[model samples]
Target: MLFRFLVFLYPVIRTLGPATAALLLIAGISLIGYAVLRQPGLWSWLAAGACLLSAGLLALLCHSYHWWLFKLRPHGSLFIPIK
Candidate 1:
C-alpha cells in the first residue's frame, strides 16, 4: 500500500518541485528588472544578482540531492539512486 502511495507521490513531487523553482527564478529576474527601473544603482544590482544566484544554487542542489547525500556521508551504507 505504501509503495503504491509513494509511486503516485513521486511524479507529483517531481512535477511540483521544478515548477516551484522555476517560479522562484522568474521572480528573482523580475525583481532585478524592477529594481533597475526604480533605482539604477550598482549595489542594487549586486544584491539582486546575489539573490538570483542563491535561487539558482538552490535549484541545482535539489536536482543533485542524491549526489550531495552521498558526498556528505562518511560511509556508504545506503544505495543512492543514479537517476
Candidate 2:
C-alpha cells in the first residue's frame, strides 16, 4: 500500500516541485525590483519572468530525460583544441 502510494505521487511531486521553485525565484526577483530598483520597466520584468518560467519547465523535463539522451563525444589530443 505504501509503495503504491509513493509510486503514484512521485510524478506529481516532481512536476509541482519545479513549478513551485520557479514561482519562488520569480517572486524574489520582483521583490528585489520593488525594494532596490524602486520601479522596473515592463520589458525587464517580462524578461525575468520568462527566465523563471523556462527554468521551471526545464527542471520538470530533466526528471524524465533518458540515459541515452546524454551521449558523450570522443575526446582526443589534450594539447590541441579545435573548434
Best candidate, TM-score-wise?
1
Q: Which runs in model 1 stand beyond 4 Å of their true positions?
A: 1-20, 79-83
TM-score of the candidate numbered 2?
A: 0.35
Question: Could you tell me which residue pairs clash in candidate 2?
Answer: none
The sequence of per-residue lDDT tens digits that candidate 2 reaches over residues 1-83 is 54344345556645575776667677757755764476666766676667667666656554643221222213352222122
Best by lDDT: 1
lDDT score for candidate 2 against the true structure? 0.53
Q: lDDT score of model 1?
A: 0.65
Work out the TM-score per prediction.
0.58, 0.35
lDDT of 1 by residue, 3-81 (tens): 3343445555466757767776787788788777897878767777776786787677668755555565445465444
